[model samples]
Target chain A: MAQVINKRIILKNYVNGFPKESDMLLNASATIRLNLPEASNAVLVKNLYLSCDPYMQFRMRESKAGSFTPGSPIQGFGVAKVLDSRHSNFKKGDFVWGLTGWEEYSVINTVGFLFKIEHTDVPLSYYTGILGMQGITAYAGFNVICAPKKGEYVFVSAAAGAVGQLVGQFAKLSGCYVVGSAGSKEKVDMLKNKCGFDEAFNYKEEQDLDAALKRYFPNGIDIFFDNVGGKMLEAVLLNMRFSGRITACGMISQYNLEQEEGVRNLYQIIVKGVQIQGLIANNYLHMFPKYMEMIIPLIKQGKICYMEDIAEGLESAPAALVGLFSGRNVGKQVVAVARE
Target chain B: MAQVINKRIILKNYVNGFPKESDMLLNASATIRLNLPEASNAVLVKNLYLSCDPYMQFRMRESKAGSFTPGSPIQGFGVAKVLDSRHSNFKKGDFVWGLTGWEEYSVINTVGFLFKIEHTDVPLSYYTGILGMQGITAYAGFNVICAPKKGEYVFVSAAAGAVGQLVGQFAKLSGCYVVGSAGSKEKVDMLKNKCGFDEAFNYKEEQDLDAALKRYFPNGIDIFFDNVGGKMLEAVLLNMRFSGRITACGMISQYNLEQEEGVRNLYQIIVKGVQIQGLIANNYLHMFPKYMEMIIPLIKQGKICYMEDIAEGLESAPAALVGLFSGRNVGKQVVAVARE
Candidate 1:
């Protein structure tokens, strides 16, 4: 078997509050076999793109289950091409996307989360974002959980991030009036001008979130796609209309806090007859085929626009992942490791 | 026209913190005609049994919408006899349960909330609790919202209260292992010994709510019918099982507070894929006939036990309404005004 240098990003320690690039170390001299072992059932792949998601922050924390182990390569959703395979479902040279390591090559044993990429007409890097985990998350969380109706008023928090940007677009496609909140003025401009949102605001600049929400959604929000939880969620609660739906997709704001901030306006939920639901993408993976059927045409027709912030190499993975916390990346953050 | 003195419980002023008996006054001098005016289209109901509900507290506050006007009789759900009717739906001598005033005689203008009682086999006072507003609330919150499955672990806050007790019994009927939390040992005893709950705990006795929940529900709670929100809700969020359902029925704990307590463990909601929905009885009134179809049979077969704490006469209404905040009234609090 041919051996190759597999550059990897390994966890140095379990992160406490606010993940730092120092917590992860890039190992450039690690070597791996290009082919799978004869008796092994795992598939060997060359990683093409690694996705940086806010949910990965949870895995970096000290946890008994689902936490990243120290001295090991961190795992995340990635686009890859199979170098060798002993599994019947996957073959050599097949492009796929699923849970893979932040390394040049990964030997994947569990095939449950993995999916073969069918359409090559679009960008392969999209498999790490719009056509992958984040895509399914936005589709299910917005369409299914929200059950939004035409002419409804929609509000999305962290609206420049991977899932939030898509949810805002989905809301517009559903014939709804949509407003979004991001961290920076550039992100707000991108949301309004590029993504076709009715209005967008920089949440960091707003001293009173409640007043900002009221100004954007004067009639009150009918569906709230919450990417940043904590204070934003509380503000949204106060501004929600009767029978409003809230999708609790991610709490990026509170993920780094030692003690998560308390939400005080929950009483508004009862007053407005609101529904708050937490969504996990894995649960909605069955809808991927349906999602592709809708999204592919929208992309081809130029009806849908997806923005990606691409990091240059595997060495940039740590900064790309850490930048997510401080709102450094404008859209879906993907690290380009190898083109083919 | 025959004139009659209508004894009424009038709000003297808007309550700020905890409501006191002095906040309301018994207006015994008020008089009204026993018959409806020639041109007026309304139902004149003789209030028989007045219900003391926690939700009425919201109406006592100074609000632009749905707040009770000062110097007017406080309104609640009650079983009434129609003395005169100008409305086509209701007629004289008809028994009804709906939103009526806390008074001896009420000329109800809006017949939208009113419902004509079909069966007379059960006690009329039952209409104030199990067979009326609270009954429909518990049924819709548990059966429809929670969607309970057999062998699921169920928990109810304010478990000894009117709606809470019924929800526990409904959980038992669904073959779920139910646990209840009340304020006193007496209520806890009633929950376990009388209501068929698997376990019952006096929350006041336990300093740490998370520890208490862990001790009772080691496997984690699958369905949580929350009546008293605030701290208990925060604790329940930590102990919820994956895909757990929570019905945000009534937040009696925070209703009187100047600032409602903030819930800190909402991240657990996303971690567990939990769903929290608010329940207002008016929203689910469309399901009342369906609820009656289920509950009436259960009541007839003695499969359901509804406990009521009767406060004699209309004079006791003020104290009875105030007692709810203190958990002073066990089970359903009903004021027996006129039996005939």
Candidate 2:
């Protein structure tokens, strides 16, 4: 085994709009020894699941402060097994999830971000979606952003994706009439049956989104977790209840559009007296432990269903990422960069 | 004077698209009883000066729930002397300003709306702006919506208008380096001199708005009070700091346009972590007295300069309102419907 072997996934070039497989390349050499000195104050971990998010598309671009450095392996949230540690807080054989490098072996200098996984009895892969950033995002956005009432009409877009699926379920448990929009019929069914959404729609077949929203939510949307912005958001604006709240967590639909789609019916926000705000999971990290406490029981009782589309081995990482933009993955798109 | 007179103004077939003076007809000989029963809780007042705003243009068109009913005299904020009072809250010789109908005399049923003027030491016209909806709006939206911190970059669109002018001054007093956009160089001058804006620009002359904002706010925008929300909004979106707040009080530029102008950079909101919120001043009615306490002193000390373009007579009301679309008014556009 080589002492300094690097398994890297480099961004091919600056992505303009929608990213393709051509934008990423996996460069690997061999295995490496995992060791850290007492003074190192660092942890050596074996990478497990690497999250493939649409926001990564932003990192792949060339900018003064792009999310990640181009021509380098993109690093993001992932689950890992600690191989060796000199940090007082971490120990060998401990499982963790945080900002791990997108490689087989990583030397994490900061342990402040990493959190030890206590409930390993559940699916370890759940850290990639339901038990991780996605879950926290959905929770904080729903509870904090909207202060959703029990009988509120909840609508989630990109409803089959990592965050959307959980939001729909949370809304259901809170007694909301939940409706979600997905790209495929299969995803829509998963939302209705598995995610416990009251109603689901395949937005692709929706002739007019305003009319579709009206038919699904005859009254109006009270809590809108806006994952996809553009025409859908414009339509949702028209269908919002008085004093409605729109939590803009992400806008996957508009992420790659060269020209932003125009929202014609935004004036409704004025008359409807709606409040729209954006949310980031990072800012709400203080609520993570409480989130797990709240979510673990739901998972054990099968009240909150978790989903993932896992690609095996580091070699499949590039294809797995590109598949996200094309909606090739069924649920939480992830790659097993390494096996413990 | 003919009884049952029609000093009323007609909506004139919804004005089709942009409003014109011809769209409204004001007939005289309209009169109503100067008194109501004590239990009626209504007050009869002679309208002295009515505030003409662009938002009233929205009420001109037939809308869902008949927001601005057609064939009705345009209604807005006004300074009125109480001729007779049936409500304990009001008395004869007292002045008030709230939602007064645009006519010579109004029998306002002070059931839920209407606030009596407690101070007449300042201009009675101040009831239409500095002490009325305009002032409270400026307070809540800028103070609460933007939640601005000292030294942060603030950008105000339509900065010479009723609300924007006050917001800019408040931001400056809060130690923010404020930059405001108006339609003319004269209006721009008013912002720098009267409003104490750090920088001002006539957006119409700027070939590149993004560049203009960058030049004025080199550090990037922390707060944006968006009164004109079309191209200026898109430009501000590009220049926003992370966690920036935008208070969307009005979008006068896009209000009357047959088609809403397309925003090509809304996705920047997600990337920059900006929050754009629509605000209705009435939601913060509980904070109105607090608003008066804060602003009355500023007005008395002459530290804050308020601007108004007064159009004489009720007959000129229609033109004064239509003038807003073309930026014809130099300051807060208003019409003196009558004089005591």
Candidate 3:
């Protein structure tokens, strides 16, 4: 066997407030053999790309869901090439995207959230977002929960975020009049221009979200795909028509706070007959095969598009993640650790 | 044709605050003919029982959903016997339940929210409640929206209100461990004895609702059918477990206030994966037939229960409605204008 090498980023401490660089630590871990042991259901693989998601911050905290152990390496989604495998579903040369450690190499136990990339005609990096967990979140939330109908009024918050952008596009494709909100002027323009939202607004510039939403949706929102919940959510609640639906995917605004913002108008939910649902993408992995069928064709046909902000090496991973909170990353923040 | 009679109650003016006796004026005006023109699709009926709901107060004020015309008799749910009809659905002696004038007799348009009373074996007053909108509201909100499961911790606020009492019983029948909160000691006792809540509390005595809820639900709430919103709903949001669902049927606490109370811990909806849905009974009319099928058996078997705070005469309707704001009424507050 050749000399083994592994470089991993471990969660240094359980984060108390908003995560900081001090919350994580980079360490050189003992390497594993590039060959799998007999009868072991493990895949020895070289990670080609890793995804940086906001939900990862939750794993850094010591909560009910599996947390990153104080001294263990952080885990996330990644695209990798199998160097050796003992699982029947995968071969040594197979390109896969699943749960892998944040390192140069990984020995993935065949347990949870693993998928082999079947159709590789498109960019393999697409698996990180538009064809993966994030993609299914938009599809399931929009199609199943929201049930967006033709000519319905749809609003998407965090319109420039990975999931929001796709949700807007999908709503538009479904014949909805879609609008979105973002934190940046550039994102607003990008949403209206490239993402094809009927209208887009920079939340930073709007003094009142209710007025902002009203200006865009004159008839009021029938569906709201919420990502940055807080005042935006309160305002959306006020403007929902009779029988509106809100898909609560993430609340990036309150994740790191010692205290979060209060919603002043939830009574409007009762008065307006609204349905707000919370969803976790991990719970939606079973829809992957159907999701690929819908999204892949959309990407190939250029009916749907996603912009990715690709960082070049392992060192840039921290900045990419932290940048999400600061509105620094333009689109999906992904790290390209190595080229296949 | 027999001499027409129309005993009516008209709003004296739009109530600026909680309704009072001075806000309404009752008149035993000349009643109208029961027979509609043969060419018309209208049903002329003699009003037997009228429903008094909190939402009717909104119709008293001017807004988007237009207020009832000032001099016209107040409109509400009623059980009536069709004296004459041009409508295909109604004929002489047919008992029906629908939106009719809040008086002795009414000429109802055939278009919306009218149903033939198929089963009259039980007390006809039940159609004003368990067989009517009140029962349907509880059935759709708790069973369908909240999706309560056996052994799930279910909490209901305003648990002695018209809809809430039934929702609590529905949760109990579902094998859920149900807890209900009422404003008075009498109501707390009634919630346990009459409504069959697994546990009951007087929210008026509890200094901290979150703590009270925690004491009742140590494992945390798996479902909350929120009838009283504002601060109590906020507390419920904080205590919800992962995948918990809240079906919001009303927010009585905030209804009459000039400014609604704000919710302080809404961020928990995303973190705990709780779903808060606001529902209107009107949209679920398609399920009404099925709703009756489930409710009738429950009522017949003594597996379900309800309560009513009946005002003796139409002159007392205004006082009963205003009493809802102050938690004066036990169970549903309905007025009996006439016996037949």
Best by DockQ: 1
DockQ score for candidate 3: 0.66
- The candidate that achieves the highest lDDT relative to the unseen native structure: 1
Once fitted onto the true fold, the runs of candidate 3 whose alpha carbons sit more than 4 angstroms away are: A2-5, A28-41, A86-88, B1-7, B28-45, B81-94, B107-116, B297-303
Which candidate order results from sorting by DockQ in descending order? Answer: 1, 3, 2
Provide the lowest-lDDT 10-residue window in model 2 chain B. B1-10
lDDT of 3 at A78: 86
lDDT of 2 by residue, A1-340 (tens): 3487778787767888877877788787645677876679899998888988888887777777845777767788899999899987889999998888888888899887798998998878788778888988999888767788889999999999999988998888888999999999899989888878899999999899999999999999998999989888888988999889888888888777767786666667666778777787778778888888899998898777888899998778888888888788888988987756
Q: Write the per-residue lDDT of candidate 3 for residues A9-90, one digit (tens) a residue.
A: 7778888756777777677656767787797998888988889898888788888877888877778998988898888788
* Ordered list by TM-score, greatest first: 1, 2, 3
* TM-score per candidate, chains pooled: 0.98, 0.94, 0.91
Query: What's model 2's overall lDDT?
Result: 0.84
RMSDs, each prediction? 1.4, 2.6, 2.9
The best candidate in terms of TM-score: 1
Give the alpha carbon lDDT tens digit for every residue of B1-340 in model 3: 8766677889877766567767788887666765677678888887777788888888888766658878788888888888888888777888888788888878877547778899987767678887898888888898988777888999988889888898888888899999999999999989998888989999888899899988988889999988888889888887899989998888888877887776777767766767888888887878988988888887788777778888887778778777888889998887887776
- Proportion of native contacts kept per candidate: 0.79, 0.51, 0.74
Residues B1-340, model 2: lDDT tens digits: 2344436555655755568988888867566655666578788888899887777766666776535666667778889999888888888998888888888888887536777888888988878887888888899999987888888998899999999999999998899989889999999999888779988999989999999888888889999998988888888888988889888888887876778876767677666667777888888889987888888898899888999899998888888888988999988887886766
Show the colliding residue pairs in model 3: B4-B31, B5-B31, B6-B30, B6-B31
